[model samples]
Target: MAKGLCALLWLQKLMTELSHSHDHIKHIEVDCHFIKQNLDSRVIQFPFMKSEDQLVDILIKAYSTLDKLSMQDIYAPLKGMDGLKDEDHRNLIGGVVGEVQQHFPDASFMVFNFGDQESQSQIPELLSDMPVMNYPIHHGDCPILAMEIIHHFLRAADGWLSLDEHKNMLLVHCERGGWPVLAFMLAALLLYRKESNGEEETLHLIYNKAPSDLLRLISPLNPLPSQLRYLHYIATSNVHSEGCLRYKSLTLDSVILRFIPCLDAEVGCHLMFNISGRDPHNLTDKTPTVLFSAPERGKDIKQYKQADHKLVKVDIHCPVQGDVVLECMRVRAGLEHGETLFRVMFNTAYLLENNLMLGLDQMDVTWDRQNQYSRAFSAEITFLEMNPAAS
Candidate 1:
């Protein structure tokens, strides 16, 4: 719905020009002018309609709502069923297939399973009535792999759903712990299809579909920021291209944390960072490396004493490239352990203005820690250099 009003106006103008020689052109032009005047005078309003409530879809496409499906088992009885008989699982899947087929007698079904490898492997046998594609997504980490999965899923889903036939139905399924990745995938798909607009709106809309505790139960670390970063990637990506922008090497000069949350009283709040991603030095490894970690071995980084309006700058000077994950953690007093305060993930190729500024609302944090930080809390990453050849 980005520039929705402009698009509507353009359509009206195009229709008017198409019938310029006809007598009806005069009526069309007058109607267009009327619409503009009413819009300007606040007599007419165009509100954003959710994807489900878009009535125009019925006029353009088939009347059935069975074209796309989303299945997230909130209770997740099927997950971790190592001891359950295979027949039991098959019966459960068969019941779902029976229901869908009963509802749309002429429809064809395709299943996209986002789960563990073992669980995904069983999908084909369980639901032999349709085609099943497995996309195993690792949780807790590996943002690079997740991005690749998203790109592939978007392309595959778009190709299948764009067919001229009316009976094509797609069902996206995920297990108990797969909600985080599934949410990200669904948001990316919605944005790709232009059914939803804007990164935050699209992402939050998908997450809001599930129960409030679904994400927190699956992931200890809030994955929204990292997911939002990928959503932005999808928004800016070219549909005809093989992939996103080419990877580029860059130097992370420093990170500035504003409104640092106070965890300790005496020594103030000690902070640490862990930045990991595909190596800029060797891209073929496929394994992410720790590009940077503050308070290395015996060294100590600066701490912010006052919790209010405090800014702490940590110099990184680390070389990184392609799908980076940056995590900020608060170190406890006299303890080696530190808890993650927030995380930000992004690709070097997608950097704009040579920096990334993330506010408190955008960064991934636990619910308890969310309200503790000020609304102005932000993390700014500044890059010192970029490879000219790669750019």
Candidate 2:
């Protein structure tokens, strides 16, 4: 019973930490005070960072720095931070509050639409040293979109601040500045670090390294469906792929049927795909859509029926089936599946183009044994449209 009470207290503390309302003790403003008090009492020396320089900027409400900083110079004061220095530290940093932009003359904010563009004009007047890119992307597009904005800022400038030079840094914000902006900055930092080490800062590196939870937090605001889909690809590559398969079926009718081949493994997982809805003859309705993590052959699949099955369904429907694109990335695998690799065979009666199967055909399946929670796999399957009349 004593342990049970402790557990409850711990849970309550966690709940308090997660809460958003700032006015209540349940929200625990004292937590910060406690840290400060401990530092002052010599109980601990909490590294005190002024609001302007706090690395975890997402938690705070706002910040105003005296001058714009290059990415490298931004870390000058933070050099002694215990866990922050190494290239391996892919830790997320956010501005808890909207920052007061000051100094840089040409720096400004940009969003997806005209309204955002207009609002950003007001930002340049207050502070113009840094480009404050506020692209609230869908959880999926956050990283890539953030990269594009960063590159734009760099190319527009005379030169980029080297990580060692630390002359200037980018200060970015999203609604809360927690997940979307956090993921993008961390991933970009990692890429920047990799490039400094004489390694290429490729899309694969950023996508493979950034945490999945960070991407999920900002998925709703993605400007383009493709950006979100690319995120799905990255997350899938990072997770487990067991008994994962993709299928595409086209009918003379408007409906295109795609099936995920059932796995013998009793594993739980999420499968995401990029699907397009189009008319075979019209070529006008060729719009792409997304289907995220619908369950297949598992208990969650059963639960899907009790709730809204549509929430888990990754199907795309169109009036006619000119072409159907199917892709799958594995999110998790069950223990029942002893191995990480599995074969997928398409049993279609119709004839279709084989080159459409995979842009690349090599399937290298590997497990990150350190994370028993996931095993990653990549495979390619060809899709072709045979004569429906034969069926």
Best by TM-score: 1
Put down candidate 2 lDDT per residue, 12-92, tens digits, no spaces.
Answer: 465445454345545456676575455446785334333334332211111123112212222222346442443322122
Go through the candidates in order and give the C-alpha RMSD of each one to the true structure: 10.0, 19.4
Error of 2 at 66 (Å): 16
The top-ranked prediction according to lDDT is 1
Q: Each candidate: what lDDT?
A: 0.68, 0.32
In terms of lDDT, the poorest run of 10 residues in model 2 is 58-67
Q: Tell me the TM-score of model 1.
A: 0.72
Model 1 bad stretches (over 4 Å): 1-88, 117-120, 138-146, 267-269, 287-289, 295-304, 307-309, 386-391
- Superposition error at 284 for model 2 (Å): 15
Report clashes for each candidate as comma-separated counts. 0, 36
TM per candidate comes to 0.72, 0.29
lDDT of 1 by residue, 2-31 (tens): 244468768656644554545545565577
